[model samples]
Target: MTFSVPSPDAIPRPDPSGADAEFWSALRDGELRFERCAACGTLRHPPRPVCAHCGSRATEWVTSAGSGEVWSFTVIHAPTLPAFIDQVPYGAVVVRLDEGVFVVSNLLDCPVDELTVGDRVELVPTRVDDELTLPLFRRA
Candidate 1:
């Protein structure tokens, strides 16, 4: 029998200079982290060197509570990227955390029809390979 994985391209590429590098590193270590602006106390996503709100370089990292709600999503009927061909019809979601930052992640552990905006979900890591750990979500 052929061995199979749920999503072969689930792992993201590494960015050494991006603000998200620390977040990805933490996720690889089994922890979830968010960026918090020291000047405005605002939370933001896709990480940044300076706070978007106040342009402050001063920021801190906070571990996420690991729960969020689906803000938006799309069910891929076709693989837009060649790397994702094996995982077609999967759901990609924008999750709004309890702390207010939104993360782009994949929704897993259920049928595609079951996904909906505002659905509660939780973070779970999937092993794409021995070297890569990916953050995917499941119904909470």
Candidate 2:
């Protein structure tokens, strides 16, 4: 049997737009920022134009403290991207920020065995390529 692997470019990348653009811009500036609805006091991420809770268009961007708790995770046993083949078994996680927004990121700087729900974590910048900077998490 033979199988083909996916390329590294198939990996997800951030789209620079609206509030999402600010999130990526902040990462390049070495910070983590989140969006909050000015009308309903709801916090959101993956930055959208409207509040998910109250359907309000009044949204504002605020800097997060870069600290959060691991909500859930998946350890990739089979790497889909060719460049990440050697890094199989890496972790992808959903983190609940202290401010109440969940951020999706990869967990790094520690062994996968130690990863667990509720583990305290902090955001760190990861160099994806020459021009890309991604937010990764590590054990706090």
lDDT of 1 at 43: 85
Off by over 4 Å in 1: 1-12
Candidate 1, residue 39: CA error in Å?
A: 2.7
For model 2 the TM-score comes to 0.80
Assess the local accuracy of residue 61 in candidate 1 as a C-alpha lDDT between 0 and 100.
90
lDDT of 2 at 91: 70
Q: Write the per-residue lDDT of candidate 2 for residues 1-140, one digit (tens) a residue.
A: 11122243755565677666788887777778788899988888778888989999988878888899999987777846565565676777899989988877777766777779999999887665644577788889
Model 1, residue 99: distance off in Å is: 0.9
